[model samples]
Target: MSHPSMDDMNLNAPHSMGTTIIGVTYDGGVVLGADSRTSTGVYVANRCSDKITQLTDNVYVCRSGSAADSQVVSDYVRHFLHQHTIQLGQPATVKVAANLIRLLSYGNKNMLQTGLIVGGWDKYEGGKIYGVPLGGTVIEAPFAIGGSGSSYLYGFFDQAWREGMTKDEAEKLVVKAVSLAIARDGASGGVVRTVVINSEGVKRNFYAGDTLPLWHEELEPQNSLLDILAAGGDGPAPMNE
Candidate 1:
């Protein structure tokens, strides 16, 4: 009997998740968002996977990279935070949950293939956003973006993100950014999901693919090469055509 090589086995694994995840802090709280596509090789394994995970009643995480790795990290952090909350007789802070993820990610950096953004509201800090990147580095920022799609968004965020944005504005920015990523990044698509947390509570929102406004090339008319050829050498067909 012949057996498959390690490379063949690895190629068949379906837990990879190339994605777009965002975290933005507003005056009152924070908004965490993610795209819903989980890919395996060039195949889309799941079109509507939930990448945002709840770490606590007030804290949520935007997961990227390998879906299995991120899910396990979130599970470990959630378990630890639950114990910590029981010991302290109060909810765990956003920093605590983020640090827990950072520690786990860093400790197993070589074995783990995931990056995460942690966002939440707490009594002490009000609203907070933290980035736990692939190497286990943790950075607190007013706004953060990650995953494959983030490569297309640095300039946009710099131009669009602002301080003291209201809750609505922050949520709008998150949704808009995720939609933009979905348009440009082949690895990012499906729907957009967001978690908004603040002193009031946590709110979840979902935006379907058909509902998101198209942008740039997406807004252009769909014309195939065959259509151009069929135009009888008219150079190019009009967009409306």
Candidate 2:
């Protein structure tokens, strides 16, 4: 039997789908999380996909969509960052990274498609995180979720994220967000990959199935909207309207 080349891998496989979630802390830092599942069609081919990567001492990246595509994109970004730093005599900026990704995606538009989240602090800009799609659109947000399970993760982030959450809070949210995504999205499962980028540096950890922490306690289901309205008791809409 002969092994297949890189070109032989099917980029359109259902299991190839990936998702990532990133949260920016109030004090100017970021936390990112991704699942460790790679699939072929409807079947899971690998359960430990490493989708989070470091581009520089200060910069980190999380990506999703087409494992092969992501690998290529990540490698290119890392290389570009390093080369750009040497050429410009400074650390690569978010704009530079985004532009590099845009150029690469444009060249291999047919073979690869990747969504990247770049986060870190800049000398002049303080802390920042930008999500860049394959089509070159870049946007900033306090928190951003991408990939198949993004919807579920976004819901968790939207409600739990606050203006000044601490590093610990950010870490907990990353774990909870990825766990929720895994539960709701079939293509996302297995271990959870967590990465923290702060003023000091970037730290990464992996949580396997048994080691993963419980996000929210198992609660008896209830009507949340009705409960909220009941709690408010129709009190003049709480002003500031």
Candidate 3:
């Protein structure tokens, strides 16, 4: 019997990436978050970036580093999952997804540099989160944050994450973690893109503008020098001022 061709196997071309991506797990499901900023070295190339991507009905993928490279890895993973489901007659599990990434990286070891986070419910593991580094190494954690802010966000997650936490609580922690990362990491800024993966599928939400707590609400009322000058403030101002 002749085996199906690659295309006949349901695999397609890969996609690329652009920015920072993170993930965390909770009781009901897992949450993936990413910054909407794309940069190379110190130069910011784009502001409205989105790393979080929906791979399947309930599976989600995100990545960081070389926007172009990351996108390819993500697209490849998505295609692999679809093909696996078609060929195996079942949804791709976290382990399979992780292994596929590793194999791809091994195939092009020196040429690829992309960190990824794959999160969703596994048929056997229930809720699962896997962080795959550039070389396809896999790591499991209650929470995982990738990209330039990986270290900073991991610190926050380490402090906030707890076993048996509810999905809502985990979501809040993820937001906080991303907010902190954006504040500290220059390449990781802009809006926070979050996705929740569960039995109900993936739910995406975007928190744009000055929504993160890093912005000071009280400082909003502070008067600018222009405003003060416009008021003709000279010499000694009033005691109230």
Model 1 bad stretches (over 4 Å):
1-11, 219-241
- Model 3: weakest 10-residue lDDT segment is 9-18
TM-score of model 1 (CA atoms): 0.86
Each prediction's TM-score against the native? 0.86, 0.77, 0.78
* Candidate 2 local lDDT, residue 34: 83
How many collisions per candidate? Answer: 0, 1, 8
The candidate with the higher lDDT, 2 or 3, is: 3
Alpha carbon deviation, residue 219, candidate 1 (Å): 6.7
| lDDT score of residue 169 within candidate 2 | 83
Model 2 / residue 180 / CA error / Å: 0.7
Q: How far is candidate 2 from the true structure (C-alpha RMSD, Å)?
A: 15.3
Model 1 error, position 147 (Å):
0.3
Q: How accurate locally is residue 68 in candidate 3, as Cα lDDT from 0 to 100?
A: 72
TM-score of 3: 0.78
The lDDT-based order of candidates, best leading, equals 1, 3, 2
Cα lDDT tens digits, model 2, 1-241, are 9976545765445547555545465566777778888778666787787777777777777878877777778787898789889998988776576567777876777776777777776666656777876665677887777888886766567778887777788878888778777767777877888877776777888887556654555333334465478887554465675
For 160-226, candidate 1 gives per-residue lDDT tens digits of: 9999999999999999999999999999988899999999999999998888989986963345476
